[model samples]
Target: MTRTVLLNNLDHQDLRVITRRSAALGDAVMLAHTFPAEFRDLQAHYPIVFQKSADGTTFHPVALLGLQDGQNLFLDESGWTGHTLPLAIEREPFYIGQDGDEWLVHIDLDSPRLSRTEGEPLFLPHGGSSEHLERMTSVLLALHEGLQATPAFVSALLRHELLESFVLDVEHADGSQGRLAGFYTLNEERLAQLDGPALAALHQAGHLQAIYMVLASLSNFRTLIERQNQRQAARA
Candidate 1:
């Protein structure tokens, strides 16, 4: 079914929908071809391509986009993942279709998960730094630069406990099994003790920016997390 969503705050103006598409080559690293398509509404000038996935699917919506879809119809369902959105696109490609006098951009949403990461992920120590705010700033810049280049990478960093020191989860093409690269919020352990208001307040601030900074400098996320822990330990 063709869905349309209202395009907002972009170089173009139009309504669009989040349609699902197939997967292609580059997507193999980060995604599983299960639901290889995502939702995108782009302009006529945008270059759309129908990539051939590992499967026989000829058309897929794995293109990196810069705008958000108005109608968010494809959200999480049942026990699977909810709202499989794109957090990053290694490259930008779309499916261009000419309909009557108007041009339409299209993609299918059935892409699956990447083969490399089929099992459950094991937790590891973070190594981001705080002693060097300059380093953090640099990392933040890089993440933003990366996101800006990839039209579909929706990113935000946070600076709150539970949602602190670590944030910014980018979407991979893993369908329901995609990982939030260089980012993570609260873990299963903190679920019950989590504070909702504190988290909301951080969001109102610039926590998203903080987390993205952490992602850009994921090489140092562990360091950052360690430093935060040390500070809390001293305070306690």
Candidate 2:
């Protein structure tokens, strides 16, 4: 259950949020929704791919955190091992809400991260927004804008026929095997075959770089497999 309410300096002056990354705090996710704005940072540590929306009508970008359901290879006993976390993961317990023509911040009171004591305070002693709150607000704003631009990005990819379904096969040192499917990746061949004008158009739209970032991110699949292998070895 969730107890979501608009955030204000009053009535919730004592609110605090635990910022630790762990599975118990709901960080164990196989994938996280991503956007072109974050591609450069995310590509360095995660394999970016596309998955269809729940209704199967459109596609959206996501950062692959693990090879299977409910598994996040970047998370461990200490914390998240990745250098950068996707914006979706960083903005926890806080979300953007609309009230008529105005956008407001909302907090989930039911979140496990919520605490009256022993966490980052949302406001300072005089009821001013804390640095933590300000940072989270920026995160929320970026996420809002990024999500708003996703549909156009997806539409561009589809118009150019640059997406192709891919299946990843993995084998651990212990002889265990797994297959990850139902995801789409950039069709490099198609991208390369496009005419100069189309290429320029994609570049002018700022998607060409994002497309390359997605390709570059595929190399991190090896990193994920390595992490899985290490986990298996530790358990052995």
Candidate 3:
């Protein structure tokens, strides 16, 4: 369980966050939650897809990192290979919390990234927030807003009937195979067939580009597979 408490400089004066990418630091994830606002940057390095929520209530967008659970192909000896990382992945140890009607920032005390002697400082010597903290605040704000806007984006896609189930089959060089399922993506056929009025509405809402970005990101599936194969080969 995550132990969360409201962050304050007094209690966390010496708090530091290790920014290095490593599996032991909780960087190994199957997929990271993303939003329409991040699709453009994320599409360049990761495959974007939508999956049903835990209760099957709704769907949210995610950037795929690996085919299997607890495996992130992006992490290596040096660091994450991608130039751009999903905001959800970058916002480690820090999370947004709700205290009644107010939003607050909370940090996981048990996270490996939390350190007192190494990495970026959360506060300055004079007890003011550091530049790193400011950037993290901005990221959290963007994430909060982006998550709030995602339902509308998903509604738009559902209204246009553009979401379709997808399955991926992978064949490794060593005669191993894997299949990925339980995800959805934009159907180009349906997107192209959208009526002009619907298309116009989506365009007006700034969702058309996001749809295309999600589609474009599918190409990264090959990139992920290659990474997995490379890791497998290295282990052999």
Candidate 4:
């Protein structure tokens, strides 16, 4: 359960947030919510895919981190091994909220990242937002804007029939097999068959690069398998 409240300088002035990467910090996950703006960086380390909501009426982009639930291949004793961590994962315990029409910052007071002993302070000695807070504020803003734009992006993808459900069959080094399902990816063949006018429209909308980034990110499946194999070997 999350105890979220509007962040204010008065009630939570001494609050500090730990930024360290560890399983204790709740980093174990197979995917993180992502946006097209982050597809480029995420493609380099994580496979970008579209995940449908539980109701199956909506979709959102995510960066794949592991083959199964409760597993993050990027996290080891040395910390997250990916070259770039997704902003969605970095923006921990802090979420953007709306008080009427105004956007407000909210913090999860019960998050493991919260600490009173040692960590980045949310405010300075004089009751002003600190640099860390400023950075977090920026992250919140970007995430808010990106999420707002995601609907249009998804609409465009659906308009062009670009999303397709797919499954991944994984064979571990020890000969055990696993399957990853319930995810969607861009249909490259269909994308290639799009009409010139449609292609131009998608290009003008800046979704062309994002689509290719998702395709390119599939190469990292090998990286994920390697990491998983390494971990299995270590355990052995």
Best by the lDDT measure:
2
The backbone clash count of each candidate, in order, is 51, 0, 0, 0
* Candidate 3: tens digits of C-alpha lDDT, residues 38-112: 999999999999999899878999999999888889888888988798899888889998889987889888889
TM-score of each: 0.21, 0.97, 0.96, 0.97
Alpha-carbon RMSD of each model: 22.4, 1.0, 1.3, 1.0
For model 1 the TM-score comes to 0.21
Q: Give the Cα lDDT of each candidate.
A: 0.28, 0.94, 0.91, 0.90
C-alpha positional error of residue 192 in candidate 1 after TM-score superposition, expressed in Å: 4.4
Residue 51 in candidate 3, Cα distance off native in Å: 0.8
Candidate 1: where are CA atoms >4 Å away?
Answer: 1-24, 31-87, 90-158, 163-185, 188-197, 203-236
Supply the TM-score for candidate 3. Answer: 0.96
Which tens-of-lDDT digit does each residue in 155-215 have in candidate 4?
8999999999999998998889989998999888899899999989988998888888899
lDDT of 1 by residue, 86-109 (tens): 333311122334469654433322
2 or 3: which has the higher TM-score?
Answer: 2
Report the candidate with higher lDDT, 2 versus 3. 2
By TM-score, the candidates rank as 2, 4, 3, 1
Tens-digit per-residue lDDT, 1-236, candidate 2: 88999999898899999999999999999999989999999999999999998998899999999999999999999999999999999999899998898888999988998899978999998999999999999999999999999898899999999989999999988998899999999998998899999989989998888999999999999999999999999999
Residue-level lDDT for 235 in candidate 2: 93
- Model 1 score (lDDT): 0.28
